[model samples]
Target: MVEGDTFQKFMLDALEIRGEWVRLDDSFAELCQNKNYPESLRKLLAETTAASLLLTGTLKFEGRLSIHARGSGPVSLLMAEATHERAYRSIVNHKAEPFESDDLNHLLGKAQLAITIEPDKGQRYQGIVPLEASNMGDCLVQYFDMSEQLDTFFMFDSDANGCFGLMLQKLPDYRSIQDQDAWDRVTQLANTLSFEEVSGHDNETLTHRLYHEEQVSLFAQEPVRFQCTCSPERSLASLNALGHDEVLDILEHEAKVAIDCQFCGAHYEFDRADVNALFGLGKMH
Candidate 1:
């Protein structure tokens, strides 16, 4: 079957240059399907989702990468997380609005955008920057430069059709982006892409338009799909975290426990007998 959305990473080892391209379809649309988001917020969340997948694919750790936005604008908070295992989740907490300005002061209106990486074996890393980028791509590029000191360029697009994005970061020990001018040229070319084209074109076609002259090597693409991490065992563990007493109280009033997985909107229901079994009151049949 043809994959819906995918993110491809390309590297020029000789030049020590690396970049990525991403397309999101069902993997991102599933999130919006669960919630009726406003046009602006939906686009923002979709872009953030595509970006999380693209950025996290570059990490070497077995952990989670989280993108968070807290703003005073019409949309207050949006978050997306992706793990090394390829599992992802996204949430937006705000009413959808038709606000169309890309200005940081206008779109987010005095807010913070944070990129956090929690590794399985090392200390968690966090980079915080003012939401000044006219778009999410610019915000991430600013974060990479300010926090990791990497020369970075990012391009992102989203619409009712789908979401697409690209990221380029110069490796360490290289000259400045200004000195080489590659960053400026690539970004300028990237800006020429329209939402309709980015959302519709394939990776090869998009690359040809942006880097036709450059010797860009496109790697084999991987399939990206919407997968939820929720399970009965996991739901029981969450109930355990809420404490046995709380579970009993919920069972007493509601007569059953119900949990709606935020990512996939899957509902899990457990009765008193199930709760008892969960607490070791009875063995499995």
Candidate 2:
């Protein structure tokens, strides 16, 4: 496996804090392939993908984590998902107009960001907040502050090569003013990191550079990859969800039912015979 698409977790042993670092290379490129997204939208999707993986790392169950953003501006919808096994995918819907601004709030006006967690054997949970900040990282920080009541810091970057992210969160053990100061110190040090540094440096070097003076324990790195969950069977199930009459109408008009997976651009076609089998009408002679 390539080291570029990797996720690593670490802890500041003495500071009662934990963090995660992720970098995406071939996986990121694969996710963006065949989709001619504008530069800004591409970056936004990449960052969302990275953020999804980071959140997935925090999960204690065997399931998936997803980040969804719906806005009323040029960018209408953006979604990213990552499973416990590290498979990930992302998609973005935007207008044809050129988005020249770098401000996220301007590009995605009045957006709502939602994070959803679906456990394998339990109920799903979701948290949603208004996208008020110019940066997604800051918006996520606000989410943790309000929902989790934990101080969290996030740094994310995307460029021609790949997308990268670093996250730090204070644990509940911080009871004294001294612990709070230590948490502030670590977060401030983390804030000093720039896009160039996060994008250019490896996890080991980045961690060492940021917290060399502190006793940090790094864990084994997990690999992340681009994998779309869409399949012909899944597409057929969706067509079934549209009800038999609607699908029959589509097939009657188009001669066949065609569906495209937005995440991977996979095309699935269901001819008359396939539709007959799907609806238990038997094969057409």
Best by lDDT: 2
lDDT of all the models against the reference?
0.76, 0.86
Regions more than 4 Å wrong, model 2: 176-178, 276-285
For model 2, how does the per-residue alpha-carbon lDDT over 111-144 read when each residue is reduced to its tens digit?
8899999999899999997888898788889888
Candidate 1 wrong stretches, greater than 4 Å = 1-3, 12-15, 69-77, 85-87, 95-114, 119-134, 176-179, 272-285
- Compared with the true structure, model 2 gives a TM-score of 0.91
TM-score for every candidate vs. truth? 0.80, 0.91
As for model 1, its CA RMSD to the true structure in angstroms is 4.0
In candidate 1, what residue range of length 10 has the lowest lDDT sum? Answer: 173-182
Task: Give the range of the ten consecutive residues with the poorest summed lDDT in model 2.
Answer: 172-181
lDDT of 2: 0.86
